[model samples]
Target chain A: MKLYEYLAKEEFRKFGIPVPPGRVAASPEDAAAAAREVGRPVAIKSQVLAGGRGKAGGIRFADTPEAAEAEARALLGTELHGHAIDRLLVEEKLRIDRELYLGVTVDGAARTPLVITSVRGGVNIEEVPEKELVKRHVDPTWGLQPYACRQVVRRLGLGGPVGRQVADILGRLYQVFRSRDAELAEINPLVVSGDRVIAADARLNVDDEAAYRHKDLPRVEEGTELERRVREIGLSYVELDGDIAVMANGAGITMATLDIIQAYGGRPANFLDAGGGASVEPMAQAVEVLVSTRPKAILINIFGGITRCDDVANALVQVRQRVGIPMPLVVRLVGTNEAQGVEILRREGITAYRSMDEAAARVVELAKGAA
Target chain B: MAILVDEKTRVVVQGITGHQGAFHARQMLDYGTRVVAGVTPGKGGEEVHGVPVYETVEEAVEKHGANASAIFVPAPFARDAAFEAIDAGLRVVVIITEHIPVHDAMQVMAFGRSRGATIVGPNTFGVISPGKSKLGIMPNPIYRPGPVGIVARSGTLSYEIAANLSGAGLGQSTVVGMGGDRVVGLGFVDVLKQLERDEETRAVVLVGEIGGTAEEEAAEFIKGMTKPVVAYLAGKSAPPGKRMGHAGAIIERGRGTFESKVKALTAGGARVAGFPWEVPDLVREALGQAAG
Candidate 1:
């Protein structure tokens, strides 16, 4: 999960990493107070999960507390990437000597832990000259050796205090990256001031699957009220755009269903995976959640293995009856007495297709009519 | 003779007494898999499904001499359970639970590889060597033993494809659900290579879902195979988004695209099935060409 810069800074401070002094302000008055507390020449950064906040005028500089308050007023409550910026972070702006990049992540292919450090920072790492970026992969079994850090430092052409500080920080950061189960821990613009090096920006992406184990990291953002309610019912539901809602049993098959919809030029409104043993209530709830979209149509794709097709059909019938079906629904039922399930759907005036592509085409037709 | 499993392969259910472990344990036993032991963390000394349930995998291995293990532990403890089985010297570990963290899957996979153990799906239906051993939660009604070897990403899709192939009178020697996770222990290439080297398997069907280079890599491997290979790729219509099932399916800003994978497989010589129903015919044609 992507943590906002301010939140990442909070984590960095906790880890003994030096950061510019900052206070989060939720309002104009709060901004003035934070500015006064930090003394003048501060930066008010819009706090949002999405990137490009700075370019969007979400960040501004203020030499006075009044200017800081005015900057905060401009940033707070402004919409960026679908998130309301209720706050702005006011921090004392530092006189920079140089900015460098350092990060650690798991190598996607080799599946080995890797630590990356680059001399270029304070800008998009992708835009930086690739040859200048110093990268070293550490053997996790052997641990992050000093030589590995020196390799990055030497390539950067820094020596003495700066090199020592970077080498030490790199070692500690790699250790934290493993212990914390972080997918990404990037210190962009690790500012150097004589003998001291401080992190100016912390961009960390923690592994979502490992979220359950970490109590220290930010709690899973219960993004919306509807999502929280759906999670309570033992079915996985995520909201989306489009006019057709899809409810299915497995993730892979659900993905295939979504793909088929796109292939057929149909838009899927959401992904609802009911897992293996889905019954009437979860099914009904899933339908209700999708129906909240009041979608033009619903695509029910259940490829049962352990899950019975007849059981899913039974749930569909109950859900349609209970909810008083409004949208046009197209379903693809296969595996585990799929014939009997199709028979049941046929009896209920629901058209069931054996083919995914055909089913998607039918749903697209239904959706267009509704649209 | 089928690969990995056959009628005589004795099995033990690690994490038996749990919901899926208990359920599939009975199913496998009914399918004629000699389920000799059950391993629960502390529920040893109990009998589940007429099989002796042991506390640890070691005890089960020591007593029952079970060479194969099917894991149904919850996701958080799945890696540990897999490690236990492999450390206890089980030759094969079939993990049924899904959604274990990627790093953990990588670690357990590395550990299993070091111990010379073959690990199947961490999120999968496991392997079924029909009329022999059934070590997973796949509905057993669809399988039969023949010359066709099936390896796939989606478990139910594999079943559907296998059923279609079998109905066409081209039964499978073994069908393996390689797990859909990004960092799964075994890849399509790993399984396809084994099937090619196996004497009994005459032809192979690889059922791949889009989003990883594994399928493309398998296509390259298939180019070297003496036996014919029919490849079927799922999710041809999937829109780019957060993975709905396996974490591996997501397309970042650049790389491992559906279009690229399809092109790669086509460049290799394996006949690619455009959809699920086409698997049987494609396999048939590939086999025919091999014979000619």
Candidate 2:
């Protein structure tokens, strides 16, 4: 769950980290009002969950209230990097003496939280030379200490009051990261202006699995309608641009099904995991959701473990009877109760393939024939 | 002879009174695993599948002499369950719960490490030595005792490959699911090192998907191994920036790409299978090469 710039800044402010005066605007009129409130030249940033927004024309500057409204109007409903822009963060532009980067994210390889800071900021951290960056692993038990932050600051060749302020900000940002269950909390271009250091841009991505703990965070609607619908049904779904809709029992096998489809010269329209141990109703709902996409073909692959193949087959039969699938459907059943599942599907005028490779080939041919 | 669990290993099922825990406990018992006791916090003095349930891991360890724990606790309490087992001095703790908070997982992993214990997963199918003892949720019929050692990040994919290998007359000594979370205990390298030293494992098959540097790190370790390794990677057609089912299966910062993992593994002298079904043939060929 990626927070909008304004929301991240709000969190930053709560942690006592300085952020430029900003207001969230949902319309051109709101943008004009926000510009007037700011009382200076402002930056109108599209509140989309995407990086490199500045380079993608998702950020625009306005010198007047009318100009701010015009800039907001241009970006309000536009899609940047496939995310719909429904709101804008209108903030006063600041004078920058320098830009620095500060972030804390999980180090997957290390299995711990890592604090990253760099002298080079306002650019992609990946593009910056590795030598310029300073990184420290923070033990989750002990957390980020002030001494460690001071060391990172000194390593970046900063000293005096500004360095101390930067160190303090690092500690505060870490608190926000830990408290929010954020997978990533970053302030790119931590602007240094005269005597003060302020966060010019904020990015906060909360861990989706940790969402149960943070119910107060605003829910951002993401993905296609079908994607959202499947999510409601407790299935993981991702929309892709292809003709064949692929459904499988687990994440690994679902991804493998997509790969096998592409390997067999077919493109997958979506990736849907029915999940482990899915019973008949959610399985039926999953098929209904996939069929609603109306792809050139539908391929259902199940390597049932705790998920019985008979349950999957029953869902297929149920969906076929109720919804009446329009697309060419291919079914592959394996593992626990596979024989019973194949028998069930066979009785429904469907021949289930035992081999995934053969099933993938058949689905690709079916999709191509339909095309 | 296996890497993790075998006939000598005594097992305790955590969250034993729950649906998954009870069901898999019966399955493990049926597979000839020494499931001596269960722990359900408040459900002590009860019997699940003829196995006695205790209130805590300490009682289970003390009464049954259980050395290993299979956790089926809910995600919210998985950390406490792991901590309990680790504190009880259990040598092996396999957490079968999914959707556990990353912070909880990190803490449990650190605590497990400090206690000199091996924590398999916070979201895994558990470990199995096939025909010896099984501690996971994998179906019993697909596996058998043999020379190949399998380790994977994905459970279903590992089952698919193991079934195919068994069909091709290449049975496994053990199959380890390293879990699909971004932060998990017992990564590819840890399991690989164990398999490399196991006498029963003549060859190893690595089932990897896009995400993290675990596979890359395993590739570095694979360079020094004497036993043959076959690698099969999934998510070849997955789009960037979108997580593919697993929380860990996303490409970020131009890293953890399928191409990169394949390159690293190939350069480390491991045979990379083009598809999951192709894994058996590659394993056979590698085994043949090692024999010749």
Candidate 3:
């Protein structure tokens, strides 16, 4: 889950990391109030869970309270990079002697937390040259030591009080990263004004799996209504822009089903994983959810491993009877009582295709015909 | 002859009394795997499918001489279960639990590395050498013993590919699910290296999805291997920034895109399949080229 910039800064403050004085505003009036509270010349940043916000006009400079309100009004209800912006982070603009980058993220290859610092900052780290960035892999067991932070700072050609402050911020940043169960904790443009260092921008992405432990973190509402509904029903779902709604048993096969559909000249409206070993009710609910999408057609591809094909077939039959599917339904079911599954579907006057390629082709034709 | 588990390997099922553990234990035993014991922490001195149940991995290892462990413990306690198995000196530990915290997974990976153990997954379908032994939850009927070795990030997709290969008269030597999480134990590179050395495997099929550099890392290794590698990637039509069910299957910062993985694998001399069904034909062509 990606935290809003204001929330990330709040976490930074909790960890003793310096952040510019800021207030979260949900409306234009609140933003104006926040600007006044922060004195004058504040930065109004949209609190949307997306990247490239600055380029997308999600961030704007406000020289007065009225300008802050106007900027907030322009951004508050607008969608930036497909995320709806309802809140703004109004903060006092910092005077930067230099901008530096500090980040802590997992190195997937090394399976360790990597602390990345650069002399060059205020820009995308991906665009930075390798030589300008100093990366240190901190062992999870020992964590980020003071010497390690100082060493990285020195390598970036910094020394004296500013160096020590940067090193101190790095240590605190590590604390926030680890304690918050963050997949990524980044402070771009770690502004150095005189001897003080402050985080000008903060980004924190908490691990979804570790969410149960961190109940204090606010939940960020994301995705479409159907996407949220399917998640509530314990299915992994992502909404896409297409005509055919697709559902499958696992993540891999669902994605493959989408690819196959597109390969056969069909467009998928959504990606839904019915999960492994889904029984009758959840499967029925999954179909109901897909039907709710009001797509031209619905295709459910199941290659059962732990998930029994018969259970999936039963759900299809059950949903067909109860909900009365308004669109063309194509199902390809195989593995683990597959014969029984196909037989069950056959009795319901529904033909279950054993081949994914053939089933995908049929669905594409059906969707195109419907169109 | 297989890369990971075979007929001689002794197995211990952790969380044996649980639903998934008990069900798959029976499945593994029915598949002719040497499932000697089970560990359920408090449910010791019991019998699950005629296999002795122990409180800890140490007892299972000591009493039954079990060298491998299949864990079906819940996510919260998955790390402790893995630590227990690793501490017991079990060289092959397969964690079937999903939703394990990334920190715990990292710790397990580090601990497993330190102990010289091969941890299969924190969330996986497990490993299988068809007709020899089964250590996972994959349906036994779909696979057949043959020359092709499969290493995949996705379980059901591998099954789909393997079933197609089997139908095309190209059976697998072994199929390893490297798990779907961002941080997993055995990666494409690790499993590919093993398959490259295995005598039974003539050609390897890499079933990869978007996200992570696992496929790219495997591509680097594929360049040096004499065995032909056929790669099939999913999530081709998937939008960027959306997690495609699998936690690891996402395109971040334009890295780990389907195009990039295909480019890297193709550059490394592997035949990249456009779809799952096309994999078998590519594998056949790869084998034919190797023979020619």
Candidate 4:
């Protein structure tokens, strides 16, 4: 649910937050044409969903249309840090005296939305000194106050008309962030050129849950190969890499399976939430998808409520009988007709653990012992 | 003896005519929960499974003396329903719906907290005292009341923890699912505080996942507690750079990672059960230490 820089900038404009003239181009020729139209000295940035693109040569500065074309040609098809760059955004580079960082995101600790502003910009916020980051949370109930915005501007040492402009933009961004159900709305390297303030880079990630309400958004990542494979088997599959693959019922247990793998000093290869109502057919497919990794070990953690452990156990048995996956498994079954599941798994020489702590610890030991 | 809800707790169901609401309400009543009223907007004057329905939570609370409400409305209307419950003077509310808009949840949660109401979830299975009362959709068949106070963000994870404890001849005092959404009314620390004060709870079995600072907050709370806690965090290292499942279980660049929560819990002197199966034993060990 991450918007490209161009789309994010469009949102910035909606809030009256200024962004330099820019257009996204699908090709080097298009980028070159855009540079000619925007008139020279453009920044050709790779339109990838990740950051640190500049360090990876996915971003380049070009002073002429020809140079912009050259940079776009070099970057448009090249894979930067594992993501293949298919487009480039040619932006008129803002000449700034100073850069500042401003952003708003949901605070996990306070379970509240926070507005963060700082003089520190043009670098990863994580890299900045924690003490220097002037951060304040906006109680969504209470809209961002001019006083609070001014305090941030004053503390960050931003002065003149630019400071008030930044405050206005921040308020608007927060409004947009809230209205759009965005997980984060960030304007990095917010630049000051004379009296003009422009957003050098815009990043907006819409919350996936909230995306259901945003009907205008194009369905991004349409049934990717991994997603398609899961859908074919009617399984919930999220790809990751490690030797251990997890198959669990419900989001909580799937997460717990992952946590257990980590706690046992193991890395989980995937998180497949078979969900609360999954049956044997879906469970078998889920196991098939999980085993497709050919993991070193597979952990099936089921805290069945609507989903019975027996059905999960039966599904695992069917998977073993039919597909014969590569990994050995550890089973932790609990709740909602668990006895039948235990009976099935035990018949297959699998013993269900009594507790998640025990199951997780054992899998760690088993995976280690196997290693 | 229970932490949140029991037979004495008066309950109302928002969205009572809906499938999830009607279904779980029956189950809660089966578990001995005193569900007195139901709210389904236009469905007032009707009864959902013998529970009288009203048009508003205010009417339901006024009519039934309902002070606690469980919501089954969809994510979009969950915010309004929660506010209505709070407005009706329900002191404790449980929102089982998931994927609520963060802004909506923020307003509802913040407003509810300000009103001195404890909101259990916006994406959780709700809470249960097990054998005494169940406020959520947790299948009533598997649970039995005992001494373990369970608090987890994931529904099935809590049931698994309870099942394991039950298998080891231990029953739960109460198990609370704080919800898996990014923003929830309750937290691990909030549940832990109640568990800490509940005398029937002799020991606590805590289940946590990666992402968010909730586990870290709970770890900090645990450092101040005198009760025995057997803690298990979901999402270990999880491949060096994986997005932890559930919106809240994120690694986020380099903060609130699973490793950090585990480290914080271990540093705070809570028994870190390496996985699900080891939790009962870890609890037994911690309880033994407390007794010693």
Candidate 5:
């Protein structure tokens, strides 16, 4: 889960990391008030989960409170990269002698936490030359030792007092990264002043699976209202840009379903997992959620192991009776209780295929016909 | 002749009193797996499906002589449960729990490796040796004893492929679900290595997805093996950066792609199947060539 800049900075402050003081503003009036509180030139950064906000004109610098208010007024309620700018971070602007990048993240391949620092900063790290970036893997058992920080600092060609300060910041950042169960904790541009280094921006991606440990973190509001509503019903739903709504039981099967759909020349409208071991109620809710997308057709694929195909079939029949599906529905049910599942679907005047290939082809044809 | 667990391998269940643990425990026992003991912290004096339960894995190992453990502990406590089993001197630990934190998985994996223990998964269906012994959540009726060894990441996909293979007169020696998480303990390489050494497994089927370099790494290892391998990789048409349910099933920064995986495996002399259903024919053809 990605946190807003203000929230991430708040976490950074709690860890004793130096960050430009900031307040979150939800409206133009609040933006002016926050700018007045800071009593200096401020940067009004639009708060949205998506990236490239600056290039999209979601960020602006204001020399005065009125300017800040105007900038906020222009961005508020506007959509950037399909995400609304509902809030803004008003932070004190600082004079920077140089911009340096530093962060800590889990290297998925190595299965180790990595500390990354670079002399080239204030730009996308991917665009920077590989030679300019200094990276070191921190052993999960031993953690980020002081020597590890010094190595990153010295490689970037920093020395004396400023290098020590940056090294200290790097150490503390690693602490926050580990303790918070963060997938990524980065300060894109750690501005270097005369003798001080401060974080100009914070980008934190917390591990959603580790959310149980931290109750203090705010809940991430994702996707559209319909998508959110479906999530509230306890189904994992992701909206996509297509015309066929695809639903499956397991993660691997769901992806395979999506792949086969696209392979047969059909686009998927959404990715919905009924979850492993889901019964009639959750399965019914899943169908209801899939209908909310209003796709031209629906593909319900279940390779039941612990999850029973009969349960899924029963739920589909229930939804067909109560809600009355308007779109063409294609289903493939296999594994445990599959015979009963197929019989139930057939009795309901719905065609259920035992082969995923047949179901996928039928759905794609239906989708194209509907289109 | 199976790679890991067989009829002689005494199995212990960790978190045996839990819903999933108890359910799968009964399934394993019914399938003729020698489930000698179960471990649940405070349910020491209890029994799950007539198998004796112990507080610690050490006690289970000491009292029952169990060499393999199938872990059904919840995600939060899965690491500790695995650690206990490893520290207790179990050689093979099969973890069926999902959503274990990556850091915890890393620690347990490192600890397991150091002790020469093979940790299967942090999010898997466990391992199954058809008709002889089963140590996973797979539906038992779908399997039969044959010369093919299967190693896969996705649980349901593997089941689908296994059933298809069974229908085509090809059964499995053992099928291992390597889990679908980003950071899993054992990879395709480790399991493939085991299958290569097993005399019962004449040919191998690798079910992979577009994630991590596990498939690529397996391809590198396959170059050294004499056994024929047939591969089927999922998520061919999946969009980049969109996680297709599995955490590891995504294409990012130009790596872990379906094309790359297929290229690597094909270059390593494995016949890569276009779809899961095609695997059976590929396996048959690969085996026939060897016999010829």
Candidate 6:
């Protein structure tokens, strides 16, 4: 789950990592009040969960409280690259002598925590030259040692008081990364103003699987209206900009169905997994959620192992009875109690296919016809 | 012989009293797996599906001679359960629990490697050696005793591909799900090394997705192996940075793209199939090339 910049800065503060004073403003008046409170030139940044915000003009600098309010008013209710700007972080802008990059992320290649440091900082870290970036893998058993922090600092060509200070911050950052179950904790543009260094930007991504451990964290930012609704019904859902909605029982099957649908020239509107051992209520709710998207067609692919196909068919029957089938649905059900499940669907005048390729092709044809 | 488990392999289940643990445990027993003991703290002496229950993995191993353990513990307690199995000197440990914290997963992996144990997954569907032994949650009817060795990062995709192979009169020697999490216990390369050494596995079928460099790493390793390998990669049309159901199934920073994975696997002398139905034909062609 991605935390808003203001929240990430607050979390960094709790770990003794220095961050400039900031406040989240929900309105233009709040932004003005915050700017006046800071009594300095402030940066007003849109609190969206996507990247490239600077390029999209979601970030603006204001020297006065009036200017801050004007910028906030201009950005508020505006869409910056599709994400609506509802919140902004107003913070004191620092006078940077130099900027450095520091990040800790889980490395899939090493299967361990990797700490990355570089002299290249600010926006577009991805565009930074690889030769400038220094990476070190922390031993999973021993964790980040004090010496390792100093080594990274040295490799980044730091020395004297600033080097020691940044090393201390790096150690604390590792602590927050591990203790908070963060998938990524990054501070791009670790600015040096006079003798003090502050994290100019905070980016944190906590693991969704470990979210239960962080009870104090606010509700995670949800994506799309359909995603939020399906989440409430306790099903995994992700909305995509396409023409067909794909549903399956397991994560693996859901993805394969999506691949097949796209391979057959059908664009998937969303990815939905009913999850293991789903009952009639959740199954019916899943269909209802998919139908709410108003896609051209819906593809239901079930290769039931622990999930009985008859139960899924029963849920489809319930949904058909209530909401009525507004869109073309191509269902492919197999495995446990499949014959009975097909019988149930057949009685309702719904023909279920046995081949995934056949079902995906049929859905593509239906989606094309609807288009 | 099978890659990991066979008829002689005795098994123990952790968290046997929980809902998922109990349900899958019964299924494993019905698949002809030698389930010798079950472990659920404070529920010792209770019998689950006619298997003796113990308080700890050590007791289960010492008393019943269980060489392998399948964990069904919840996410919060998954780390301890995995450590217990490793500390008890079990030869193989399969963690079927999903959503284990990354830090805990790293620790479990480090400890297991230090002890020279094979840890299957923290979110996997487990492993199966068709006809002889089944230690995972895969449907038995889909698999048959044959020469194909299957290793996948997906559970249901493996089942679908295996069933398709069986439908085409081909069978499997062993199938392993390496888990779909970012920080998993094993990878395609690890499973591939074992399959290369197994006499029963004449060829390998790798099921991969867009996320992670495991498939790329496996591609590099396949260059040195004598056996032929065929691959099928999912999420070809998935957008970048979107998590496709699985946490590890996202393409980040242009690293784990479908194009890159297919390119790497194809360069490694493996025939990459575009669809699940096409895997059997590729496998058959590769096997024929090996024979000729």
**TM-score, one value per model:** 0.92, 0.98, 0.97, 0.91, 0.96, 0.98
TM-score of candidate 1 versus the correct structure, residues matched by position? 0.92
User: What is candidate 3's CAPRI-style docking category based on DockQ?
Assistant: medium
Deviating ranges (above 4 Å) for candidate 3: A62-75
Clashes per candidate, residues 3 or more apart or on different chains? 2, 0, 0, 21, 0, 0
DockQ of 2: 0.80
Sort by lDDT, top down from the best: 2, 3, 6, 5, 4, 1
Q: Rank the candidates by TM-score, best first.
A: 2, 6, 3, 5, 1, 4
* Candidate 5 residue pairs in clash (backbone atoms < 3 Å): none
Per-residue lDDT tens digits for candidate 3, residues A1-371, read 88889999999999999999979999999999999999969999988887789998899999999999999999888899888888899999877899999999998889889999898999999999998889999888778999999899999999999999999999999999899888999999899987788999999999989999999899986777888888988889999999999989889999999998998889999999998898899889988988987999999899988899999988988888898898999989989899999999999888999889888999999999998
lDDT of 4 by residue, A1-371 (tens): 78888889888887788888879999878888999888858999888787898887788989988888888888876787777789888989778788889999988667788888888888998788978899998888887888888888888887789988988888888887887888899999899888988899999889877777888866555324876687556555677767788878777678766765675688777778887678789788778877776787888777778788788888988998888866678888877788888998888888898566677777777677778
lDDT of 5 by residue, B1-292 (tens): 9988888999999989999999999999999999999999989999888888999999988888999999998888998999999999998999989888877877787788779998888788889999889888888888889999999998888888899999999999999998888778788888998999999999999999996788898899999999999998888877777666777787977779999999999999899887778989999998999899
- Winning model by lDDT: 2
> Could you give the C-alpha RMSD of every candidate to the true structure, in order shown?
2.7, 1.3, 1.7, 3.2, 1.8, 1.4
Pairs clashing in candidate 1?
Answer: A259-B237, A259-B238
Q: How well is each residue in B1-292 modelled by candidate 3, as lDDT tens digits?
A: 9988999999999999999999999999999999999999889999999999999999988888999999999998899999999999998999999999998898888889889999998779999999999888888888999999999988899999999999999999999999999889998989988999999999999999999899899999999999999999998999998999998999988888999999999999999988788988999998999999
Q: Name the 10 consecutive residues with the lowest summed lDDT in model 6 chain B.
A: B132-141
Model 2 misplaced stretches (Cα beyond 4 Å)? none
Candidate 5 regions with alpha-carbon error over 4 angstroms: none
lDDT of 2 at A368: 92
Can you give the lDDT of residue B154 in candidate 5? 88
- The alpha-carbon deviation from the true structure for residue A159 of candidate 3, after best TM-score superposition, in angstroms, is 1.1
> The CA-based lDDT of model 4 is what?
0.82
Clashes of 2: 0
Tens digits of lDDT, candidate 2, A2-110: 8888999999999999999979999999999999999999999998878889999999999999999999999988899998899999999989999999999999889
How displaced is residue B278 in candidate 6, in Å? 0.8
Chain B only, TM-score of each candidate: 0.96, 0.99, 0.99, 0.97, 0.98, 0.99
Every prediction's TM-score for the first chain? 0.90, 0.96, 0.95, 0.86, 0.95, 0.95
Ranking by DockQ: 2, 3, 6, 5, 4, 1
